[model samples]
Target: MENSLEFAQQLDRTDPLQSFRKRFYIPERNGKPLIYFCGNSLGLQPQTARLALDQELVIWQQHGVEGWFEGENPWLSIHQRCKKPLAQIAGANPSEVCPMNNLTVNLHLLLTSFYQPTPNRSRILTIGGDFPSDQYALESHIRNRGLNPDETLLEVFPRPNEHTWRTEDILTAIEQHQNSLALVLMSGLHYYTGQVFDMAAIAQKAHEIGVPVGFDLAHAVGNVPLKLHDWGVDFAFWCSYKYLNSGPGGVSGVFIHEKHHGSNLPRLAGWWGYDEARRFEMTKGFVPMPGADGWQLSTPPVLAMAVHEAALAITAEAGMEELRRKSELLTGFLADGLQETATVEIITPPNTAERGCQLSLRIKTGGKTVFNHLTGQGIIGDWREPDCIRLAPVPLYNTFEEVWRVGQAFADFTS
Candidate 1:
């Protein structure tokens, strides 16, 4: 307690955005603040979220039917209004983006539009350790096409002595399977290991081989700078709960490069994707909106959109370049501190450019013991299945002092 209090004092002295901490609801036990380091999972709620949501609630109560058209935030163009700032974060044009369903659902929708398997080339390639949701989506998509996953789905893995696959190895896998690849799908940043993959290089190589490339940016969207359209990625999807600081199960987004916007692509049709000009004409068939907005399947969730809009405004306000600057400094500070702890090894790559706000620490000894110790002491970081602890110092809300404190907590646990 003494050490934690002293660390808190030090943090208070040096934190640049420390005032931002008060903008969130901090979980507590017995009237003390519990240290939160799980922004990589679900970010703390923003203070503005409630106000944004309530603004709509008031409209709903005062003018039930009119609110849909005349509300302060009109339900009609609500989704459209969110695109510009989100596009800024995604490195895309407004027309190339849309906020729709959850991450997995959006991935499935994108596959329907982009993953058209031909007789000779019907396989989808993914990384070996992709998130389970993505794995299942890929397997199901292949099976639905009357293709066997065992034969059609290829997985690229790390070499014999490595815990993480190198960029070169992944590119080699793409080359080896190029002849039969219908699509090359990958996570922009790995979930478990916290390694940011080289999206530009991977996309370029896959395109060279005549295979379309897509990505699940659930961990990368707000954590790193992306040049999605410039990289020539066919499509991408991301959830907003993590680094973007929208609440749990908040809205997710998708991107479709402009090149495919006018193509005669087949997509799962829904009323939401119908052209807005004639949407209320009681049309019998779907008329798709151009660009990524064509993928929408249902009415937009206004409350969720409000929460995301608030967060996106904050992200655009802070600017990715600035957030990334703080992120590199804060994560590197944690990495440096862990090295001196003498009982932990960082599994994630050491290069700041190769990662985001997270550091995956493998405790050589007292793994769970250290995890539990931190928990008991009111320091909260997440632990993966067996031995790794994931610490994310979100640039918007986390401070360098917190990084040092978490480090000392590890030292105390090791001792």
Candidate 2:
């Protein structure tokens, strides 16, 4: 693809999803809209979000205590309503998915049930440089079980000098450690370098040795095509605030394979997860609702779920198949535009299959200066510490021309 405004505009004109750009509020500078390439961090606010949230507020104002049962969309079963779209996004059956607490909280809860250390098999196999919350949660859980973190957590690092991991290295780690591994939990997609791990391969290797496997899909859910159920992932979790565009601190959820729904796998139970038919009975014993709904720790936040429902509907309407097709083209065009810039190094994997919307650039010199200049020119991308700038041209609202302008902004940077 040529790096020219005419070419970029032509691509936008022919894009089937071009009209979708009007559905969200694009951030602006001065009077015009800025180039927004930060959807991997937080998505743009959907126009429907305001109306959805206001509906819940009105329910609260009118019915107060009875809102859970009274409104057109009752709060009592709001979590259930989200199941279908969430399942579609997660690539799991509705029975296996449920929206609940935030990411870290769900991480802790899932680890409690999944990380069962024994005398012979008592270690966890994971990747180095996963999201910090996953690292801390694993460490705390290891310590809680009277084991040392350094001994129980085996992290597979990148080979020698590489930004992204090799699938073979990870597979070997799991195979070598399988004898002593009780759980294998890792990020489906790397946060910093924008690498998509070979999750299907990783899960297959772990399960071959009878080890329980899971993934932190915080970056993978809406950004890529996932078949968590077909791939036999034991469990997975993610946040909706990013590509899902539910809003900041939006509700999080989990996918528990249906096989475990009937089994007595341990879980940290709460009142909200109680068996629905007998919930109001207020019985003493905790009988969990069947399937992934059993993982809920508290009442689902209606306001947050309302916004989530509206945003998720848009994703459902577009469908992941179509979204992924456009995403690859957009990122490929961005990659080609910057391939010749002397000061920039593309650290993210070049293969379309190994990445989604994000492309992390390690600027060789004056990285922050370059980032600031881009900002001044109405190019909005985020700066990671020391030397990287992240630009994610989200397929939902971002356009071909905006990505083209970013390349122009770089060429015009004096440094």
Candidate 3:
């Protein structure tokens, strides 16, 4: 635990998941692997991803149009193959998980079903400074329902000079707007601050007020432990490219609680959502498939799903609990190391339970220049606007020595 290279190397030697690092293709600069600390943005590609993609390519070349039903992994039911693994990752029933469209697209689709606004209870409650795509999707969806965003969108901001929201304040806001709150949309982990929200408690509080709750787990999924079904979350969606390690622009996954799956909840349905039994019959009425598959709008992208399959397989083998334990240690090491430096502030929560792997650093001055220096040294991390740099020590592929190197980079830059 000492702030020394030997200590860091010792920790890496004893890490249970150290072998996982070999599964990913780490990007290099000048013939050496960069100290990658940006898995929260986009994950490093899995070494098996190419093989997975190639399998599908071979299927396409051999079978062509018949590939839908005549292949080792048929295109028709490829999405279903991902359900069990995705469910394990998100802590939901296989029936409740569906691998489908992109994150924003899935949000719009899920909103169509869950974001129902009555005359009196039409406002949507969410946190401020959410991912821009989420904000855009929520605002546009509200406007689509003939509602004014300013009046219908209720955003909770952290107190002045604060970096994260307090759970008490979030619950208080929910109580105050219970009557007018139509939906409670929040992130499982804040992308910028790296603060984890009490999603289960938040969902319970919202449900007590008769408000439907959902979460965007873009930053949480694969990085943190989640129990969507146990939490009674009405719905949730996340992209696969981050901690999930699917390739860039990977297909996203959705979780619809079992309670809503059988309901006549309104959704923007498509042929893919139709009952598989009657799909070939070309039925007149749209009979939705059971569970989350009922929410899917189109045919699955086999290549993308193949990549997800490869990535999810890795997660399934490693297990979330094991990965999370390593994540806590890795981030904790980074936090402790950063605390020794004077020029930067670690804004992420000190408690391991309140964060994933990301640590958001606020540089006192020359933030971008310092970031550039880190990059030049092959220490890769993401720079957020204003003056913050985000670094994620991903448990699956990142190591303790890498965290030490980053701490050293910061000290060198500041000194």
Candidate 4:
């Protein structure tokens, strides 16, 4: 590769999607706004969000109850409107996807239906280093089933002294407890390390063991290309606040493979989850809509759906494949630049297929001083416990120049 600094500058000048950088709210340090490379946590708000939200507000004011059936975004069908684009993003059939509650809430709803633990196979196999919310969700699911979380939940961690878990080790664990494992739940891309797990392989293996597989795609949904249906995954959930460019606490989505469309499983159902054709009838018994929409427990939030539509409209315009193409270049540029410097060490996997736009760095001196230094300069990468710091270059809005600046900032700190 060319010299790291020169290459970063060159990439910036030539980036086809570089013009998108001006569309976000970059924070100003002194006069100039600092580079944002933390889209893995909460993505920056789109500049178009205001207009989209305002349109909804105006309709609500002008129409009142009539807004439910009328407006640019009719309240009753807003969630359904989001389903098509979200399905495209997740690589699933539109009937298999739905946007509703937040990430953990959706997870609970999915687990309530999908996780049917029997006597012999009551255990859940999850990654050792999942995000705290995922861990909590698993614990709740296990306990809610009248089983002990510690006894039924198995967390597979990396070998001692290793930075990330290996695929071989994970598969080995699955093979060992194949009989007891009822579900294999994992993050599509790990939050701290940014390691994109081999979901297809894992799901294939889990299915062989008769174990249903689910994934939390919070960091992976927009950051990497997903094929949940083709991967044979039974179910999956994701938050839009990350790489999807949806604002913080934005609506989350879930996917249930088309195979589960008419299954007569007992789900925690509500009015919206009932068949839409009969939803307003106040019928005697609950009737479910096919696929993931059956998981919704309450009415759709039109305001949140508007925000999701606005953000996803941008993603839809910039096709996921194209976003991924820019993402590979942007993240590759950041990785290439940082690896050339001696002071910074990347904890995320080096292989492009093993990671997304996120790169987790462990400073030579454990991250304390370096983290403070970067935040002081108005750079907004987050620090995890211990020494890891995560930075993400969101292709939709982050620029190649910002990636270079972040590298320079890290190089300066380490030097």
Q: What is the lDDT of residue 253 in candidate 4?
A: 91
Candidate 3, residue 330: how far the Cα is off, in Å: 0.5
Candidate ranking under lDDT, highest first, comes to 3, 2, 1, 4
lDDT of each: 0.87, 0.91, 0.93, 0.85
User: Candidate 4, clashing residue pairs?
Assistant: 37-392
Residues 45-134 of candidate 2: C-alpha lDDT, one tens digit per residue:
999999998988988998997999996778998988899998998899999999999999999999988899999999999999888999
* Backbone clash total, candidate 2: 0
Task: State TM-scores per candidate.
Answer: 0.95, 0.99, 0.99, 0.96
Q: Give the range where candidate 1 is weakest over 10 consecutive residues by summed lDDT.
A: 1-10
Question: In model 1, which regions exceed 4 Å deviation?
Answer: 1-19
Report the Cα lDDT for candidate 2. Answer: 0.91
How far is 236's C-alpha from truth in model 4 (Å)?
0.5
lDDT of 3 by residue, 223-339 (tens): 999999999999999999999999889999999999997799888989999999889888688999999999888888889999999999999899999999999999989888888
| Residue-pair clashes, model 1 | 0
TM-score of candidate 2 on Cα atoms, chains taken together = 0.99
lDDT of 1 by residue, 362-408 (tens): 87777888899989988888999788999888888877777777888
| Candidate 4 lDDT | 0.85
Native RMSD of candidate 2 (Å): 0.9
Where does model 3 exceed 4 Å of error?
none
Best by lDDT: 3
